[model samples]
Target: MEAIVPGPDGEGLVETRLRGWVDPASALAAFRFARHAPSAELAPYLDHHWVVTYADLAEPYEQRIVSHPTVNITITDDFRRVAGVIKGGFSYTMRGSGRVLGTRFRPGGFHAFFRAPVHRLTGRFVEIEEMYGGAGAALVAGVLDEGDMGAAIGVVEAFLLSLEPEPDPLAEETAALVSLAEEDVTVTRVDQLAERAGRSVRSLQRLFRDYVGVGPKWVIRRFRLHEAAERIYQGRDLAGLAAELGYTDQAHLTNDFTAVMGMPPSAYARLGLGN
Candidate 1:
């Protein structure tokens, strides 16, 4: 087994709520957030572990979380379940005082545990007990009862250690491919990704459907839009930003952004500026 490592601080792929909300500074002032790296044995199937607490919130804080192409196992005061990939943004309200411990599975990592095509899980969640039986129930209770974050994380780690999922090479490959789409700005199309992966477009699509719970095209477009959102928040020129993000024109980017974000770039920029 390889050594466990700590997750990076303030550099996670998920963007902070401060970018999308107004007067978040006061609400965030009472929040405690941390992400931890998985043990090396679980690294390929797990992205990172996260714990968030807002025990001292004077009022409810609504947090806007950006979407990502990964599944997660989240435990909170209300429920414990495996959540599928969210196609768009979602909000969670933190009230009074509580904490959430989450395990973010890699793009293809959940397949090891699900033993099926991950596409079935998209846009939905499954209760932990449905998959892991009584042990799952005990794990959730133990983690929630533990006051310390380290102890809570340890309970989860021990549960996963018991499962002993076998390594899946395809999951690793799919994760690497998705990482490329996220990191390489030039990878804007399915054909480009197929060429880079040395696979036919159809093969690539199938791979994504089975493991990633989405098509390659969706992944490419999602990452591009993510980049556009950040740039738009930074006050970049829409026309020039569209061209840079591989959009045909500003209108094309606007339509896509409005469809997913429920607002035009200019309106989003206004929100960003107002905050």
Candidate 2:
């Protein structure tokens, strides 16, 4: 079972299924991961309702995630928070048995629910209560107590529906633009994106900061790096990947990959092979 994503404008590279998991085979082995569709009403704002469950593990499993350029609302025994676009990789450890439920918001779709500039949440994790107050706390408790996985998702969907979020065309536009940045490898530079969007580079940056929670360049590079990881894991050449991803040189690409992924492309490939 693979997660197949479409390329730019429904065309281009479609090889990436595991968007940015450092090791998909190992992560799948570590736990049970599933994605459920949100209700029609909430579809505009959410991408999916994802759940990870594991039971009776003999030892702790740690997974490194090269997170996406989107906000996430995660509820679990340890914490319930609105997570921002993590600028770099992060890790989570699981032991024994437990469940983690999350709502992955579309690139700009979170603005409807938070009703504030989304950039403030970038690289930050705020307790749901801090933003949603008592109502947020109640949401955590309600979902945790719900035994049925689908029912728990329903609990969250219903809460979002109550917010009465109206569709924002700008949000939709932002999501689409973000998609272009993601799927269109040709869009390696922020200026190129601004040109495509018919906005000045400054205007494009402002739009991204307000809606996408990061500058356009950051988003562009992140997606490229995601592509790089997927390709390298498939045993692609490093020099070719660097050139294709718009790095000044292979070393530049290696530096960037090592910085975010904690290893060079070659080492990452070897680890994937080991798994």
Candidate 3:
């Protein structure tokens, strides 16, 4: 996929990334997007993301994409595509509010959180919501023209504020773990993580499952793999990448690259150059 970062004079008041559909000629379409959070949350939160959307329709249909952090009072649009069986349309995403850690989706669609520990086990694909919120529409609308994504983000944040304040210690811990995982993908194993967090391995496992939606080991593995992919795309040295990422050997890294990314590291390097 090809991505372009929006310029300073762009529509959305934030840094935006657009991943063009991979199979530009096919009926099915895929798009990945991410928006930088407001300056306040940039340090630890990284950015909000929406990815892996698929759409197909034969008639008029609308779905509500619920909020992940909270759904009781948020107002966002459905992730929508209005096209035919053989006609292709892009499924896009809009994300904002780095302060919020998790959100929900309407049934029949994927639900992803910022938690890396959980992601390592489940992989990237998930089924949580069937539809998306109205905010997604605003994010993608006039995207090429560089419209206002910040306004859409504001809308989603407002909704999160309306929910009840039920404390989720487990969720909080999971979010912390995710933040750590993203910072360093090579740090695997629950016991070590638990030691760092001052918690027992069993407690960490339970908390991760409850809030992160996946196991801790899986999170480390997936994050490492994602880092490897990013390195490959950026033309990093393969040997250095493997060593820096704590791979046992270059062969181990290659096997992981092939198994998870569906191609050797060099293939991604070539593709990264837009060849």
Candidate 4:
């Protein structure tokens, strides 16, 4: 698989690290996953472009994906739409041979394209035709018909170029704050994020609700859970890991993990280790 990277004028593909897979090796063996960067003009609004392909096999492979704070536009053999934040783990079964192409919008970036409160899209799916009319449907058909990945990406780039929305300064600022929360494990509280962003707690909440479709606290907790999944896979001590992740204690950590993952950390670790 090619690593995702920035190309001239933001046309290059970037590398992606898969997370929340039940069996990483098995999944990798069963599918081909790749990611590409949006054109420079579209980078502010898009995180990256991703494509997954697999051939028909004896049994359909069931893949479980974790939730993120951003929105996505996905196109498959017969489906197409803009999807909002997935609240929890969801499974997609790969049946007959086919490809699925998707664009993950940066946190808060969809606001520019939607021109409405992003919170309205949370946990919802909007038809592409509703947003882009016949043109959008044509784009989908063109991409599906094109067998070349590069050509398909070009079609998507052209589509975004046609709907270029005015830049949203607040979307950029919100993206910066969300990036901090995702990368810094020490950022465990919304109050801390507010202080860092030079805003009050209520102001931060409103900003996130308007643009990100989720609260600051939810972002922080979700990021920590992502960290937990990784550390548990590496066989880290749950007690120390809990303290490090800013949970009240191990029980609290386990409770949160179980709620989202549908399994305790210990069980997940075993699955990760292929035990």
Candidate 5:
């Protein structure tokens, strides 16, 4: 088994939503990250596959992530588990050298693979075997033993295909709704999103709870915060951003940004200046 030795992770290989990194510049220096799409058969349920490899650091580097709303299944030496949408921020520390192969399921897409409501996994990490029994354990072992990154991902994809993804119209609708919340900056409130989707606010809430693992409001604000991070890093005006992103005021935006990035916009902007 040969480990993957790769060059710097280029911007095109990563997603823009990865702005959740507390210090995007530093995070890039510390690790190599790339995302790949799943097979055609698994496309409906998967966002894409991701590979992270890091090595030869003089000291351990901790990376803070302002988690996305989707679920991820990560296989690495540190742990092999299923992680649901974290309602807040989280961190991972890389030491010596290591690699991680991950599967990022689309918003609402995991429901096709999970038996219960998607919310059950929110803010939680479950051992893969706990969810899929022996087959799940096998995936962990196969990925761990395989040195080649591509073959490792192939093992996981084979396991996912064996699960037999069954498409649900509601799940597809939920994915579309999440995309709208993420892509449309004008959408500031859940009610606005509900109206756009032609559903009452209450019904919309039900759909998100059942499929997205969080409310539409959280999704909309989080995506907006992602945009805010990028703009602020570029030295944009916070007051103007708050208005454009639907925050009641700059303070509200600050609270959300602080909670996720572990710092307010002003401080984050200063760090951005160094980059």
Candidate 6:
């Protein structure tokens, strides 16, 4: 459930923003390609890692039901070459659809979530038949396959892991923002968050939008909804739960839940815990 986040080395953290992460131990890495495509834009920065599909949609396209900050496992009928940023989280791809396969990461300055066989290590996206255990092991195998950049990969991996996951570096403010929002559903002002993060309101908003693909207010609302959903799914009384979650009333909660989840709380309870 570990994701290897890219560091400020090699490309030196170019603003282009193709974030990918692999577990140091290679527990589970997610390589994601993201661009602001219509269908693609709906998927958000999930708290857990998820794998979704990339394909051509026909006319009368409908937006995906699942909300952002949630994982998606995409399915497509044909092959396609995709371009976008990849980010990782602490979860495995629960299910995959269609005929697509996972691919491996090769030596040539490759940033893979996991290792794959050299022969099958093509650039295009396909399912990886075999997965390497961790970054080090994957690098070693990739080095054996292709002689160049083996040592450099090792050094880079080492350097990335050695760096502290703290301080003002690497947008530490994001952690704070997440913490504050997760604590309660009470609406928070952007200016308040900016003050707490020691950043200007505009800068914080921009950072959240750029990295999370959603504005701060939206993120907060989603978090609140997630909590409400969890409670309702756990057999909590709808009216009481709504009040506890800071909703004005049961009707208020119901409208919001139905809007976001595409179903009422009662239906969700009958279905399952997660959406």
Relative to the true structure, how large is the alpha-carbon lDDT of every model? Answer: 0.80, 0.85, 0.42, 0.83, 0.86, 0.39
What's the lDDT for residue 110 in model 6? 20
What ranking emerges by lDDT with the best candidate at the front?
Answer: 5, 2, 4, 1, 3, 6
Structural similarity to truth (TM-score) of each candidate: 0.87, 0.93, 0.54, 0.91, 0.93, 0.42
> Candidate 4's residue-wise lDDT over 1-275, tens digit each?
11343432345454676655555556767777777778898998999988887877678888877778999999897579898887777767898788889999999998988888888888888888887899899988888888888788889879887887778899999999999998999999999999999999999999999999989998899889888887787677666888888898999999999888878988988976773
> What is the Cα-based TM-score of model 5?
0.93
The lowest-lDDT stretch of 10 consecutive residues in candidate 4 is 1-10
Inter-residue clash pairs, candidate 5: none
Where does candidate 2 stray beyond 4 Å? Answer: 1-16
Tell me the tens digit of each residue's lDDT in model 3 across 1-275.
Answer: 23443322244433332222222212122222334443333212223423222233333322112112111112223422311111111232433311112222211111122223333323232222312345434423423132344544444444333332233455555566666765665576667678878888788777665545455665566566666766666667676777777677889989876665556777767866663
lDDT of 2 by residue, 198-248 (tens): 999999899889988999999999999999988788776666778788888
| Model 6 per-residue lDDT at 121 | 28
lDDT of candidate 6 over 1-275, digit per residue (tens): 12233322222221222122211122112122212211121112112212233233232222222232311222223322221112211222323322222121111112212122212322223321223236434433443343223243343234223322122222334544756776655644667667777888788767664434446666566566767766655567665666666667889888987776667877867754432
Report the C-alpha lDDT of model 1 over 1-275, residue by residue, as the tens digit: 01122222334343332233222333345576656778887887898887777666777778766568889999998789988887877767888888889998989998998899999988888899887899999988999899777778889988887887889899999999999999898898999999999999999999999998999998998888887777676667666777777888889999998877777888878765764
| Candidate 2 vs 3: which has more TM-score | 2
- Of candidate 2, the 10-residue stretch with the lowest lDDT total is 7-16
**CA deviation > 4 Å runs, candidate 4:** 1-14, 20-22
**Cα deviation of 40, candidate 4, in Å:** 1.0
